[model samples]
Each structure stands twice: as structure tokens, then as C-alpha cells.
Target: MNVHFKYEKNIQIEHLETLYNDVQWYAYTQDLAVLQTAITQSLDVLTAWDGEELVGLVRVVGDGLTILYIQDILILNAYQNQGIATQLMQQILEKYHHIRQKVLLTEEAADVRHFYEKNGFTSCDQGSLVAFAQVR
Candidate 1:
């Protein structure tokens, strides 16, 4: 199977809508406008494709210097467990490693924690505590 990676300028909003809607851990139902705004504001985004189909994607949101946040790493259900997500992340790290900026986040699952660790992210007990308001 051949995998191609592309840094996209204008992702088909429908593709993102489909991926986000199908992802249980992500909350994309609030409003389409909000989702559109968030996607528009992302600093950089990488998408992986198997021919014409989008198989995986990851986005980086930050100031482009000093700090970066990795978000929305997703691989379609049909394509999971085939190292597609890992490859997507590897490409992100390769592009950003030289900056040596601190990347920070809280993952939703232990399996995801392990995956992040494998990608050189360390668990930090000293990281800030985050609280969120209840979403309706």
C-alpha cells in the first residue's frame, strides 16, 4: 500500500466534518461555525491519503515558535493499527523537531498516552491542571 502525505491549505470541510463526527472522543457537534473557525485557525495541518481517500490526519495549533500543541490525530477506523497514525506523527515531529519547542497536552486514553510516549513525549506530573466547563 502506498501512503502519501500532504500539507493542505484548504481541507474539504466535509472530510473534517465526517472524521470529527465519527470520532467518539472529540466533541464537534456544538456548531458548524465553531468547527469551521477552529479549522481555519489551525497553525498547520498534515493529512495522509491512500490514493484519493483521506486515511489519517493530525494538526498542530500554536504560535509557530516557542510552543506547539498537537491535536486531532485521527486514523479512520478501516485504517487503524497499521502504523498510519504513527507515520503521520513522525512527519509532524520531523518537521518541528529542530525548533525544540515544548509540546504539551492531555490525552483522552492510556493507549494514547503510550503512543505519545513512544513518540518522545514524557509524562509530566508537574504539568498544569486543566478544568473545563460543562458543554451542553
Candidate 2:
């Protein structure tokens, strides 16, 4: 796949919906306006495109200096396991290499855990750190 990556925020809503829906992220797809606004307000957004098709995306939200939170990383279902997600993540990490506290929250599946762990992220449980969330 000749995937090209771009540091872009002004993504077409159709493309955003396609990627998010294809990856089964239905919540993000529910409100296109909100999704677009969120993307526009993000600190950084890296998108992977195969020609005109947006197959992957990694978005960060934080103050560029101290706290970098990886808000989203998604790969289209057909494109999973092809290293596109990894490359997107690698690039995001590289871009925010100077930021000391990079964080991500994901569901507790084995594959999900393994993916983050392999990408150099440690579980809060493994360290002295603990994470809490007030998900509505």
C-alpha cells in the first residue's frame, strides 16, 4: 500500500466518517459536526491516506510541552495488521518526543494491551501510577 502521511486537521467530514465508521467507532460517527470540531481543536492530527482514501489516523490532544494525550488512533478494518497503525503511532511519538507525559486510554482487551505495550507504553498498574476516569 502506497500510504502517504500528512499532518492535517482540516479533513473532509466524509473521509472522517468513512474511516471512523469502517473501524467500528460508531460513537464518533454519530455526530459529524462534533467530530469535525474536535478534530479542528486537536493539538496534532496525523492522517494516513492511500491515494485519496483515509485509511488511518492518530490524533493528539494536549499542551505541546508537558502533557500529550493520544486521543485516538484508528486503522480501517481492511487495513489492520498491515503496520499502518504502527507507523502512524511511531510518527506521533516522534513528533512529540520532547513531551514527557504521553498518555493513552484504551479498552482492556489482550490485543489492545499488547499493541500499546509493544509501542512502548506501560500500563498504569505496572507502575506506581494509577489512572481514573469519569466516563459518562
TM-score of each: 0.81, 0.98
* Candidate 1 clash pair list: none
Per-residue lDDT tens digits for candidate 1, residues 1-136, read 6888998737676777666766654566457667767766898889988887777788888877767788678887878889988998899888887666646566568788889888887766536644443546
**Candidate 1 overall lDDT versus native:** 0.76
TM-score of 1: 0.81
Q: Would you list the clashing residue pairs of candidate 2?
A: none
- Candidate 1 residue spans exceeding 4 A from truth: 126-136
C-alpha lDDT of residue 136 in model 2? 70
In Å, residue 44's CA in model 1 sits off its true spot by: 0.4
Q: Name the top TM-score candidate.
A: 2
